[model samples]
Target: MILGEFWRGLKSGIVELLSALIAAGLLFALGDSAILATITLSSFSSELKSESVLEVFLIDEITQDGIDSAKTYISSLSGVSNMTVKDPEAAMDEMSAILGSDMTDVLGFNPLPFSLEVRFEPGSCDADYLNRISSGIALRDEVMEVQYASEWLDNLEKLTRTTYIITGILLALVIISSLFIFVSLHRHISTRRRDIVRNLRLLGIPPQSLIVISMMRAIFVGIIAGAAGVGITILLWKLCCNYVVTIPFLTTGFTVLAIAAPVLLALISLLISAGRSQSNLFASGS
Candidate 1:
């Protein structure tokens, strides 16, 4: 009978329930955005220990001798991340794919330079320090056009900032919406007070039964929200993978907690509401 009732109510109330659950799912997505920004900011704020990963692309042309000499020069730099040499031909091939043309034809020659990739400790990503290091290297007679830029960090910072903003907005919406769920449920129960009391008093239904039923309903909502939330998040992750590092939708712990916590909270809130409503009904009948 309870299962039948649940299904009946699900069909009738599907629209409202789904809207609320989807709102919950949106919160899950924003959770990831917040996670990424926090991680990135922490990475930037952390102190330098030994070395950091730095990638430098050379767009200028150079001879094999120059490549070897550049490698030698970079090897001598203090606190090098790792000096890997990318040849101009390799760079040109990559450029062609990105540009969709033979850049060499337009330029009349290979303009790609053999740039040294220098990695330093975490703190070394600073613009002023990087400029000093690169410029200081360029002053060497053999080095040509060593480049470092504050602009290099701009795009990364902007991306994290954007994520932070989106997360904040979505998080607020989710919180407001989650709280709305309790309000809606309470209103529905109050409106159905006659039906609820008639059935309970007629059947001598224990208070525990109502509480358990509400808990079950909450679990159902949570499962749907978790599944829907995870599915949407994965779809987005796939789309972003083409251009950026799209992290996995939810780590195991977060997935479990996201599903569990909201369900528990909803069940508890409804249980309390049920008790208060039932108390009023019993009092009025007396």
Candidate 2:
């Protein structure tokens, strides 16, 4: 019966199937970890960028109306996310809290000028954009100075770029390794079933049926491998959850990909193997 032959084929290739499963599972885990780390770094980068603030100090001669106008102008700027006015008194209070002593007691008068704290949108935190915005704000008559930590922003930008490059390289390597594993496993399966396949072909069995059987076997192996990979990844993620930050949607998406990747790879491998085996068998017969 066909069922008996299918069982025999499954039993014969059990070792190859197990090897493929183990190799694919480990590779998938490595790939998932790299992706998760990249996402976490990106999240941290965005958070730090959101905290960046530009301080615009007002001239001593500027009236309250002038201060209000400056605030309104800065708030209306294209990239500005937020703008808060801190009067001289508030500035003094903040300095006092930092020093743990009343600044007024030592200075007799607040020397700090009224300033606007401006925060920009994430993509707008680059050095060039910040410089342009700061220069524009400085040109205003009421503005005495515009200051921000440009050096810090530059360094953060560099770090983000490096993370992206490294993540891309890692993903590429994982994909290549996965393809190699699938191809090698498919070849081994083809060799093991060579005699049986040749016999079936001579008996007038349709080539399509043989290809489908091989594909089914591959699909079965892939499902088992994908399940193992996903389980391992979930376990490792839980164990390291305290140290790593992850987005819920990203994690869910990666998990789905992990399960889907092996099956997809298997399908590709079976198609390749089927073509090669059919050709070799027909050539020998002729």
Per-model C-alpha RMSD: 9.0, 3.1
List lDDT for all candidates, in order. Answer: 0.61, 0.78
lDDT for model 1 comes to: 0.61
TM-score for candidate 2: 0.84
CA lDDT, candidate 1, residue 14:
66
lDDT of 1 by residue, 86-143 (tens): 6678878988999999999988998776656566655545544565567766765556
Error of 2 at 140 (Å): 3.5
**What is the clash count for each candidate, in the order shown?**
10, 0
* Residue 10 in candidate 2, Cα distance off native in Å: 4.0
The TM-score, computed over Cα atoms with residue i paired to residue i, of candidate 1 is: 0.52
Q: Mark the 10 consecutive residues where model 2 has the least summed lDDT.
A: 242-251
Candidate with top lDDT is: 2
